[model samples]
Target: MSLTSEERAYIRSQSLARLATIGPNGPQVRPVGFVLNDDDTLDIGGPKLRESQKYRNARAHAEVALVIDDMAPADDPIAAGWGRGVEIRGRAELLTLDAPPMAPDFFSNDVIRVHPSRVISWHIAPEGQARDIV
Candidate 1:
């Protein structure tokens, strides 16, 4: 599996992630809404996505990184670790849907699809074990 059951659950529980891309000047990072598909791919769609610099960057340079993460609330006395996260290093491609976008609430049909080549997870598994897939 591209992601373990626990990892999938962690991803589904979150609503935001940081998408990093290479721009003309340097690396650009932004908060983005994403959809994780059954095929283990990530779809990032937004209004006017095609006009954004990120889209242009992905089209020109496919390499990218996405990070979804959170820290335990201070009140959660029994929570594991100081943080939990997943980092995906992958190749991204520009794409469009036929009608509705993957995230229909406030996104458009234009999207960037990320096919993960390597995954790094920390503080997600029980016993706080970290793993890497490359």
Candidate 2:
């Protein structure tokens, strides 16, 4: 399902996002700090010039999955009761230092721009049904 503006906003407000990329060997996952830009693009900062496999994979495939969720502890039995999760599927573009209107400090290394193609979300429910917010 597509994501609503509000839902997307909520996802963006979260503290962290998990990035999934595919490499020649297999899938790679990394935790990243990010910012949701006003232009409806996700800005990911990390060093790209360095020999990072994830960046290399993104440069090659462009397709990526990003997941953001609220913190819920397993020890807290009630945690599951509070359902809050978001998933985004999109094409990732590497932002170079030469890119215009750059915010290099957003990431410590390099930055990746993700243009979402699909978004799905779920709010807490006792029945555990993940309904599409869009």
Candidate 3:
């Protein structure tokens, strides 16, 4: 599986994430709505997605990172790491005309497919342990 049970659950539970891409200027990060595809890829779509800088960046760089995080109860009552987070690093491809099917709310047919190479998770262990899945 591309994702562990916990990672899948965490991803599906969240509605929004940040996608980072590199361009000639530098790294660019933006909030995006994404769907986990059956083929273990992430589909990021929205209105005018093809015209966005991120889309152009992905087409050029291919390498990208997606971070999904949220607040949660921690194992330690007073620990600073009281939140859970996951970062997915992978290659991204821009799908313009023949993109995957998306939800009705998706504003555009264009999508960016993220094929994960590494997954890093934190504050999700039984006792706030961290793990890496590759």
Candidate 4:
């Protein structure tokens, strides 16, 4: 399924995301920079991607989770609540693609495309309730 406008916009506004993978020792989570591809798959790249533990872990286990979120600026200083974000759980695969022009010099351009099976979003509703998409 395609992403909602809100979802797409949220992704575009963020630069960092948490990538979760299963390592040989156990579960591993790392901060990663990604681009939201036209096809809706996240293109994640880094230096030495082929040799990275995350890549190895993805090759061994496809299951993964990616979280993109941040605290929304509070209009009312006294207002308190939870932060807003999206969590994508799905299978991942490695892809070797031409690097985006904006990619850092250290990036290798190899990326992991996550095929989301489920998406959970919080604070997107008018009532601030979490819901599943796709």
Candidate 5:
């Protein structure tokens, strides 16, 4: 399934995510600047993106996972227990970056495009209980 409207909104509100991919040394995860596409996909980019290990890993292993989340607000009623997040398991496509949503000066024209195969969101979770949004 694809991302729901709520999931898209949450992702749009955030700019960073943790991209995990398998590499020669096994699994590798790194912080990335992300852009939510109109097609329900995500573009991960950063400075020297083409030279990054995550980019190389995505080229070798097309499967990847992205975790985009934030701790609940300090005043949130469930701040001590619940949080908001989206975990996406998808296929990665190494491509040229286009119209990044983050700091344009810090990102190169390279991107790891993620096409979601599975989407799990906890943006509206009830105190530690995570559920699928799709």
Candidate 6:
């Protein structure tokens, strides 16, 4: 299913996200700390991080995919059986300077901003399919 405004907003509000990029070797995955900008751009910050392979890969390819989800089980086991998740497809761009200030401990390096092209939401069904709920 497609994403609703609320689901997209929830995905942006998340603090932790998994970024997927195309590296010289192959596809690379990393857990990143990010902030959602008012303009719908995702700001990722880290020290020395800007020079990392992920950064280089993004610069070369630009295309990226991100996933954010709540992993904790709900108070009710039945409710917990259903999983909630958000996925974003977008192009990543390197932010050189004048970026917003993040917490000192937020990300140790430079920031990579991702502008989403598509957003989708998912839930675990009783039959166990990761069904798109939105």
RMSD of every prediction: 2.0, 4.5, 3.1, 2.6, 2.6, 4.2
Q: Write the per-residue lDDT of candidate 1 for residues 75-124, one digit (tens) a residue.
A: 54435447888999999988888854456776888989999999999777
Cα distance off (Å), candidate 1, residue 104 = 2.2
Per-residue lDDT of candidate 4, residues 1-134 (tens digit): 56666788878889999999999999999999888877777777788888999999999999999999888766623223558888988889888877641366878868888987888877654564467966
Candidate 6 vs. truth: CA RMSD? 4.2
Q: What is the C-alpha local distance difference test score of each model?
A: 0.86, 0.70, 0.82, 0.81, 0.82, 0.71
Q: Report the number of backbone clashes for model 3.
A: 0
TM for every model, in the order presented, reads: 0.90, 0.71, 0.84, 0.87, 0.85, 0.75
Give the poorly placed runs of model 4, Cα more than 4 Å off.
76-81, 100-104
Comparing 1 and 6 on TM-score, the stronger one: 1
**Given candidate 2, what's the lDDT at residue 47?**
45
Which residue pairs collide, candidate 2?
Answer: 45-107, 46-109, 46-110, 47-109, 47-110, 83-124
lDDT by residue (1-134, candidate 5, tens digit) is 57766677778888789999999999998988888888988888888888989999999999999999898676665444457889999999988745545678777888888999888877444455555543
Q: What order do you get sorting by TM-score, best first?
A: 1, 4, 5, 3, 6, 2
Local accuracy of candidate 6 as per-residue lDDT tens digits, 1-134: 24456565566656878899999889999987777766767777666777788899999999998888775366634336455677778889887655434666545536888887876666522225433431
lDDT of 5 at 17: 93
Error of 5 at 64 (Å): 0.1
Worst 10 residues of 5 by lDDT: 125-134
- Superposed on all Cα atoms, model 5 deviates from the true structure by an RMSD in Å of 2.6
Output the number of the lDDT-best candidate.
1
In Å, residue 115's CA in model 3 sits off its true spot by: 0.1
- When 3 and 6 are scored with TM-score, the better candidate is 3
- lDDT score for residue 63 of model 2: 96
Which pairs clash in the backbone of model 1? Answer: none
